[model samples]
Target: MNVVSKIEAAAPAAAVEAPAERMRRVVAVAVEHGDAVDREGRFPAETVEALKRERLLSVAIPAEYGGEGLGTAAVADLIAQLAQACGSSAMIYAMHQIKTSSFVMHGTGSEWHRAYMRRIAAEQLLMASATTEAGIGGNLRNSICAIEVEDGRFRLTKEAIVISYGNYADAILATARRAPDAASSDQIMVVIPNDANRTIDRTVVWDTLGMRGTCSDGFHLEAVGNAAQIFPKPFSEIAAQSMLASSHIYWAATWFGIAADAFNRAQAFVKAAARKQTDGTLPPGALRLAEAAAKLQEMKGHLMAAIHRFDAAQVDAARGDDAALSSIGFAAEINALKVAASEKAGEVVRIALLVNGILGYKNGTPFSVGRHLRDTASAPVMISNDRILSNTATLLLMSRFDTSLGG
Candidate 1:
C-alpha cells in the first residue's frame, strides 16, 4: 500500500493557541535568551522550547493536518518579526519553514507523509535540512552521498557541512544521489525521522562571530527507513517551485527584520537627543536616520515586489506552478532579491551604529547595536554574493527585456 493510503484522519485533533499569540510569547523567550545564546555560542533552547509548547512550529504545515496553514506572506512576516529579537532564532525558524515547504508541497495525497504531517502538527517537531555538502561547495543540487536500497529498506550516510540547530531537530530532510550508482546531480529528498529505531551520528562544534545561537556546524548523518520515506516527486521540481523561492523569501524577510531593528534604534537615538534641547533643535543624526529609513523602504520594495510576483501565479504560491516557476527570468529575479537583502541589511546596521555613537557600540545594553552590526555583517556573506552574481549572469543572458522595469 502507498504511504498516503495507509490510514488516519487528514488533520489532528489536538488544540493550541493562535499563531500570532503563540509567536509573541516565543519572541519574548528568544529575546531573553538571545544574548547568552550569542555570547556563549549556545543553542537557543528556550526559544525552541517555547515554539514547541506553543505549537507555532507547525504554522507552515497545511491546516488539514491540524496546522495553521499559513500562506507565504504570513510566514515571512512571522520570521521577520522574530528576527528583530534574535537572528539565530529567526534563522532556525526560517530553515524549518523551508524544509516544511518540501513536505507540504510534495507530501499531499501520500499516506506516509500525511501521517508524518499529522505528527508534526501534534508534536510541534522541528526539522533540519542537510542539503549542503562539503564536496559540492554549498551547491544544493550536487550530493556526494548516495542511498543504498535492499529488502524494501534504504540506508544513506551523508556529510552535512552545516546543519543549523541539528542537535535539537526531531527530523531531517536530506538530499542524495537517487541510487548507489546514480549521477551526483540526480537526487532525491528523503525523510529521516529521529525515532528510536533510527540512529544519527553527529559531533559538530559551532563558534561564530554572529548568529552564534544557530550552532550550525558539520555533522555525519546516517539513517535507515522504508523506501516509502522518500518523496514521490523529484528534487528538481521541489527546488524550482518551493525550495528556492521559499528560502529567498523567508531568509530575506528575516534580514529585513534585522535591518528594521537597527533603523528603529537609530531613529530612537536621534529622537531622544532632540528632546533634550531647549530650543527644539533637531539632532545632527536625525538626517542620517531619515536617509537610512529611505534606504530601508527601497530594500523592502525590492524584496516585496519579487514576493508579489511569485504570488501572482495564483496557484498555491508556496507549492508553485511549473511554467511560472520555471521561467529563467523569475529565477534571476529571485537571485537578485537575495543579493539585495543581504547587502542592504549590512548597510542598515552601519547606519544605526553611526547614529548612536559610543552607545550603539556598547554591549549588554538596550541601546547597544553591537550585536545587530555583528550579525548583519555576516548576512551578505552567508550564501556568498559572488556565487549568486555568477549564477545570475548566465540566466540574465537569455532573459528578455521589459522596458518598463529597467529592461
Candidate 2:
C-alpha cells in the first residue's frame, strides 16, 4: 500500500477506545489526506467530516453536553499528535479548542449554550477563532469591535483578520469591546454563525514559510447583528474565566509534536544511512547527529513532564485552590520547551539535509525535512520567549512578597 493509504488504515485502529484515541484517529486521517489537500489548497474536508462522524471534534464539551469531556492533557496530546502529521489540521483543531474555551467561559448560561453544544456534538459545525485583528493585534484592551446595548438588546460589529478557519467555519467565536463601564479588559465574546451577514474581505493572505495549510485568511465583519445571546455576565468575569480555563496547553502539545516529528524523521534517516555507509568508518557528522537526537529526546522528556505537572495542578485547582501555580509553572516550562523544540527541530533538519544531501531535496524521498523545519520554526514566535520568561520571573518575584497590589 502507499504511504497515505497506510496512514489512513491506521486511523480507525487508533481511535477504537477513548476520546483522545478517537482524536488521534482523526489526526491520522487528516495527515493521510494532508498532501493532497495542501496541493489543492483545499480544507481537509474528508478528515474533518470523519471527526464529526466519530465525535472527535466535540470531545471538549462538558459531559452533559453529549460529549466525551476530555481535559487539558488529553486535549494537548491529541493536538500535538495531529500537528506532527499535519500542522494545518492541528491549527484548525486548536482554533476549535480555543472557541470551546470561550463558550464555556461566556456561553454556559446562555439560552443557546446547550443547543449550540448539542449541534456541535451531532454535526460538523466547524469552529474558528477570530482573535487577531489588523494593526491592534489581539489585545483585549484596545479592541476595535464594539457592542452597543439598545432597548434590551446588543448590536455587535467587528473588523478582524486572519481567523484560522475564516474561509469556511460553521461558527466563529469572536471577541469585541464590551459596552463601556464594564470591568477591566471587558472584551465580550460571542458565537456568530458563518451565515450571519459577515463580509469576508479575504484581506491579508497566509503566505508563510510553514503552516502553509492553515489558510489563515483575513475577514471583516460589517454590523452583522445577531440577537447577541448576551453571555449573562460582566465582561471581566468572562476574561478571567478564559484565562483560568484556557486551551493554551493544547497548542504547546502541537509544538512538542512538531519537534518530535522532526527528531523521528532525522533519526530514521541517519540510522538507515549509517548502515548503508558502514565502510567500517564512523564519521563525525553521524556522531554529531546522534548527539542531537539525544538532546531532542531530553527535550521531549521535559515536555512530557511539564504536561504531567500541568495536569496535576489542574486537578488540584479543581479540588480546592486556584491553578495559579500550575498556570505559571506551565508557562515557564512551555517557554523552555518552545526554545528547545524549535532549536532541536532546526538542528535535526540541518542534519537530515546534510546527511541525505541530494535525496533530501527529492520530492518523494522519506528524508525530505524542509516542511517540518519550517513548521517547527513557528513555535518560538507563537509564544514569545521573552514574554513568557518575564511573566514567570514576575510571578516568582511577587510570590516572595507579602505585599498586595493595592494599599
Candidate 3:
C-alpha cells in the first residue's frame, strides 16, 4: 500500500478527524507563519497552537491511552508534510513524537508514565529532549550528571548542550547516570515536567543560520519529581529498542519535507519560465530539475524503506522476537538511512536552488528557495553525520551485509 493508505489504515476506528485532515489544517498555519518564525528566530507558537487544537501531539500514543495509535509510517508522513510547510515547526513536531514514542514503547510498565500518556492525549502537552550534555561532547550514552533519589523522590541537574523548544515544552525527557557512583554509560531516562518544581536557566543563545525557530539553546536543567517518573529500563536498552530508530526515521522525514518544498518551488519556477518561451523550447534549468527530482525520489525511497523495516521490527518485537529490534543489521541499516537522507536532502535542495537560479538565491521571491536550502543544510550537522558514520562503521564490521533481495 502507498504511504497515505497506510496512514489511513492505521488511524483509530473512533477518530473524529483523520490524521491527514488534521495535518492539513496544521500545515496551513505553519505555512502562514513560517517566514515570520524564521525571521524572528523564535518558536512557531502559532503553528504549535494549531497542533494542540488538532490534537496531533498524541497521535503516536497507543489507543489504550486515548491516542490514535498510529504506526511509524503514518507519523513520518505527517511530519514530512509539516516540514514542507515549515522546517522548524516540522522538526519541533518530530522531536515531540520521538519523545512520545519512548514513553509509548518503553514506559508502559510504570503507572506514572501510563498516566502521563493519558494526560498528553487529554491536554496535548509538548515534550522536549535533553540527551546531549556539556562534558560528554556529542556522546548521548554517557552523562556526568546523575539522578539523586531520596525519600521516594528524585532530583537531577543537567547541563544540557541543546534542548529544542525547551522553554515551551510541558515536559522534558532527560538522560543521566543511574546513580552517583554508577558508570557514565549506566544512564536512565527521566521525565521532568516543566512545573514549579523544575527550573531551567538558559546558558547559551540559539542564534543559528538555519532552523533558527527551533530555539535549541543550551540550558542548566534542574528538576525534581517522583522516583516513578524514571523509566525502569536502562537508557541503553531504551535507545537500542526505540529511541535510535525513531530519531533517525522521524528526522529523515523532516529533512525530506524541507527538500520536497524546495523541489516544488523549483518546479514552479521551471513551469513559469516555460510559459514565457516561444516554440517548444524547455528552460535551461529543466534538466537540473529532473536531476533534483531523482535525488528527492531516492531520499523518499530510503525514508519509506526505513519506516517499513522499523514497523516490521515492531511487529516482530510484539510477537516475542527478542532480537527483532536490536539486531546488528537493523541498527546499521537505520543508521545508514539517517546518513544517506541527510546528505541527499542537502543535494536536492542545492540542485533546486540552482534550478531557480538568482530568484532562489534571494530571500523574498515567488520562487525563492533560501529557507528550504538553509533548513536542509542543518540536517547533516544536526547529529553530525560524521559521528553516525563512525558508529555505523563499527556495527558493520561485526555483521555481514545482507545482499539478498528479500532478506
Per-model C-alpha lDDT, please? 0.82, 0.64, 0.91
Scored against the true structure, residue 336 in model 3 reaches a CA lDDT of 93
Number of the top lDDT candidate: 3
lDDT of 3 by residue, 1-407 (tens): 85334434544442577889889999999989999999999999999988877779999999899788999999999999999999999999999999999998898899999999988887788999999999886798899999999999999999998999998999999999999999999999999998998999999999998999999999999989899999998999899989999999999999999999999999999999999999898988999999999999999888888888898898898887849799999999999999999999999999988988899999878778898878888988988999999998898899898898893
Best-to-worst order by lDDT is: 3, 1, 2
Q: What's the CA RMSD of model 3 in angstroms? A: 5.0
Ranking by TM-score: 3, 1, 2
Q: Specify the highest-TM-score model's number.
A: 3
Q: What ranges in model 2 sit over 4 Å off?
A: 1-16, 20-28, 39-41, 104-107, 138-142, 180-184, 223-247, 277-285, 316-320, 323-348, 383-407
lDDT of 2 by residue, 1-407 (tens): 85334544654554367866666667778867876665556677777676665667767787687566777667767777787777777767776876776565456567687678877765547788665677676454356666777766566656676677677788776766776565436676666776655556676777776776777777776535555455565544554434323444555566667656656666676677668775778643577667766766775676666566555655665576545433544455554555665566566556666765666666556766666667666766654556556655776765553244331
Candidate 3 backbone clash number: 0
Q: Between the candidate structures 2 and 3, which one is better when assessed by TM-score?
A: 3
Q: Model 2 lDDT vs. the true structure?
A: 0.64
Off by over 4 Å in 1: 1-18, 314-321, 405-407
How does each model score on TM-score?
0.92, 0.80, 0.95
Off by over 4 Å in 3: 1-15
The true-versus-predicted C-alpha distance at residue 65 of model 2, in Å, is 0.9
Q: Lowest summed-lDDT stretch of 10 residues in model 1?
A: 5-14
